[model samples]
Target: MKPPSSQGLRLTCLLLALASLCLPIPLWKDRDSLMQEEKAQETGGNLVLSRQEQQLNTKLVSLKKMEIATAMTTGQFPPSMHFFRAKRLIDQSKVFNIIKLMPKGAVLHLHDYAMLSVGWLVYNATYLPDCYICFTHTGTVRFRFSKPHPPHPVPAQCSQWVLLESYRKQLHNVSEFDRSLVRNLTLVTDAPEQAYPSQTFIWKRFEEVFLIASGLICYAPVFKAYFYQGLLEFYEDNVQYVEIRAILPTVYELDGTQHNKSWSVAIYQEVTRQFVKEHPDFLGAKIIFTAHRMLNVSQIKEAIVTAMALRAQFPDTLAGFDLVGDEDEGHSLWDLKDALTIPYSLGVNLPYFFHAGETGSLLQGLLLVLHGHFHLGAVLTSHPLQQQNFSAIILHFKVKQCLSQPQVLTADTHQSN
Candidate 1:
């Protein structure tokens, strides 16, 4: 499949913000209105530079000064504005376009299910052989595959399945149906503020979309295509390598044959191998195997053991383990510490790469960082990821966050910065 457009790549900023642009201190916008320092602080101002890098730095510094002056004159606050609003103007940004051309080393933490465009999933995946679609009673959609004519059981929540290709034929305006399906697969909407009433409501809707997309992506053929598509998108964005936070989803073939998580892990490795072979510049990708955080101690331990076994087989492919879900509602690091210590008791050397502090719990935030010291040391996300939301807006993330407001995080945003 062809890679997504630059506009789709711009959404890549949200993942980077949620994954990396965080610190214990609240992220501050450096607009003249917010701060008035004679000399600005850059992360590596003291570093020695090569001639080429120095030239690039001089040019970038001039551009930065010009942007700050522009914002000061217009008082538009492009870089300091919320990215939800800033994104509408990102295409015209020189800084973002240049960053897109620069090589980014690694994406240490990004959800496997969310790296690509829903438009791709809607138009591409549904056209495959034996694919069927059904609407759940609660109005969510699901996809599955079976022999073209088989007596198969439908999900208990859903109505009977309609072959997607045939269903498209029955539609007078297939484009409208496809658009609706895209909306079902993603939280994108014109009135996201109206769509997401509360944090709990929004999180629930987010999980529902995850479930819907998993049905399509977890099918065997689509799994390979989707993984490769994600890789292609990152490669196009000049990201050299990635570390995907993946669930060991149960993939099923058209013949109703179910494959375990090991099959899924192997496929990830195969896709990465194929991508690196095609694009030798790519340093290759790794999977940080994850499980739901809401699971009990027994279930969490089983997941760790599962990760250990997979890592022994695919040492490079299966990178580590983590528990993924809503941190506020799910069991915290303290609650799951006993289970997290399983790798050590067995001396299995499994590492962790967990995402935390998206919600506003000071205790949870401390536990997540402290959990690293407790065992299986991990890193934190405190670096600036250059994204298209205007250059100044990169520092607009709110780090000392409590439960996030819909407006600040963006109504459709997956998580807080």
Candidate 2:
């Protein structure tokens, strides 16, 4: 098919303009009002707005009244009108005042490290030792020092990890594969199955980045800055509560002052308490302890034991457990089911959020226990060839079992209704 001629495009634009004017007086009036405002600004005179401007302003007020009516009646604005009014409100610089009137909720899937703003990282480094950073031969920018100085300099570099001045400016250079890396490592993707063909390959790369960043983030004083950064990001997003999945305990000091789960929990709690005190809107935080599948039975047990202990100390703050690391090369939660059972029994009250049925598993007796939970019947469907329903079924079974009877929030008449 040939492209439309220039005359055809001109006619289409005119028709669309006429159609818009005929449909809504507010649309045409709002545009006319904007033109008048531009003219007034250019002329440097305080001339009264035209009838169109008055009509547009009146329409805006009417829309605001309708917003309140709809929200009161249905608990939310109509989807179409909501976006239109919201855009106008924000453009008028009243978004914050408007949002402050609404009740906000919790933010999920916030990674603690990336939340740190560059401003905080640089500003705080001036007062802390080991905040000095340099580019290593490997080209990865990391914090380490012979003396205390400014935070990692703007546009500084390390092996392959360079801090760009602007994320948007550098975004164009990031390829689709790199974008996938960012999403997988950062927990930005919702449905990993549709996002990736093999969790085994994706997670292998994920663990490698964690290993690399661990050493880079462990420098003294970075933890404090990191915590604050995460808090600030949550604040900026209008989140009242945050349940960040932090892997802080995985990082260690240069002299081997290995930060354990306990230390990480202490740091997290301290920061959370201080932040909530300063910012009353800031509610609370919880932890999701993640263990590497590459760990041996003993190591896995120790990790779970640490998680259990933390849960005991901070019952409300510590949420649950997760398994991370290379899925293909290492033993999965299934392989360590017997070893994990002891901890599960001991921490029976603690919740479990296992990552199950992701990439490359044997089908032979797959019916056997998956991470100590048996798979029941699957919801079979048509068109088996094109769909990954077989894989999704197992994941569904894992989620079902994980959220089953034991922690089903049983109602108790023992307490007042």
Candidate 3:
């Protein structure tokens, strides 16, 4: 009895814990009955519903449940299937029409170049009187607007410049050529995954399409009309407002007159104003000035300065600024910090709407978050993250205030195609 030994004390505590665990606690004898009772109690607290409302809710639930069950059992395709696969079945289903009838909110992330149909671009825009076409050695085509001229020294990469009208006449089937051109200008294919094996490959083709499209739409006459048509298309789809990501390239006239960036921005403003006037139901639109990330530091600074000037000129229409390119191959945001700081130094506020984390890199995403301190408010990304690291970054850094709207994933019908 000279004080209990340590081992004896441990054995005593263990026996006491086991005895407590084995004791019959006053828990519900029938868990199923308890669950039903609690559920009834909870439902009893809810507001009373009419018989018709209850029936409608039940019917909707049953329909959704049946759809899911059928999809699972019969191996039938569901609406939630991959967009490419679902799109194939769209023509046969009412879902496409249902979506078309739905009122879509402001389309905030559309590229100006891709707002219209490629068929319209090739057939309508490129079919203009002065429109010129050049075929590259790499089996791609480029279109532009210029007055008719005799054949001259052509670029080493291009075969020669010819009138699109004449070129169409030479083709055995003009309709087939137009269709093939549309296919080249878009990602529509039988097997998209096979055609575009990797992001790098796909991005290369994407940029190529932009190049081919820019030549057609960047013509002064077509540029103005393009904006109008784009607005009309969006309005017809029940989208009242849109924010277009635009690269304000130098627009050229058929007479070889080059218009500066300001002229292009002015045209956009005028066209948008006129469209809104004509379609009073349409709310409005804004432009997010974008520059290629492949630009040098000087070029980036120039783009920012140009954007600032446009913002000053059209304060209501110029929304923000962004760097657009294949993020995987472009320079990092940190690398261009000095150039990006120009707006701050010049006493102007050009808030950054940067494309970040598209490559799904934690380091790149963190850099973007850190840059948020200097007016980097929103990031455009398509990558889906399941990790908690993104949330952890936001919480740990207290970046909620800096990232005002968080990440925006731009979705367009053509992207799925």
- Name the top TM-score candidate: 1
Segments of candidate 3 deviating more than 4 angstroms? 1-85, 150-156, 361-373, 376-417
TM-score of each: 0.76, 0.48, 0.73
Off by over 4 Å in 2: 1-104, 117-129, 132-138, 145-209, 250-259, 326-330, 355-417
Clashes of 3: 0
Sort order, TM-score high to low: 1, 3, 2
C-alpha lDDT of all candidate models, in order:
0.73, 0.53, 0.70
Instruction: Give the lowest summed-lDDT range of ten residues in model 2.
Output: 402-411
- Candidate 1 lDDT for residue 133: 86
What is the lDDT for 417 in model 3?
22
Put down candidate 2 lDDT per residue, 259-303, tens digits, no spaces: 666777777888888888989877877777777678898888877
Residue-level lDDT of model 3, residues 1-417, one tens digit each, is 599999999999999998777653434446666776787688344457789968856866776576567667867553444344555555554444545766776766568788986788877897778777788988888777776562345545876788888788878888888888998788666765576666666778778888889888888888988889889888988998887889988888877788887787778788888998999888888888999888988888888888888889888888768778766678777767777778766667665555454543336645645766344343223212212222433332222221111111222322322
- Residue 258 displacement in candidate 2 (angstroms): 5.1
Compute the lDDT of residue 267 as modeled in candidate 2: 79
Give the per-residue lDDT digits (tens) of candidate 1, residues 172-212.
99999998898898766666557776667778888888888
Better of 2 and 3 by TM-score: 3
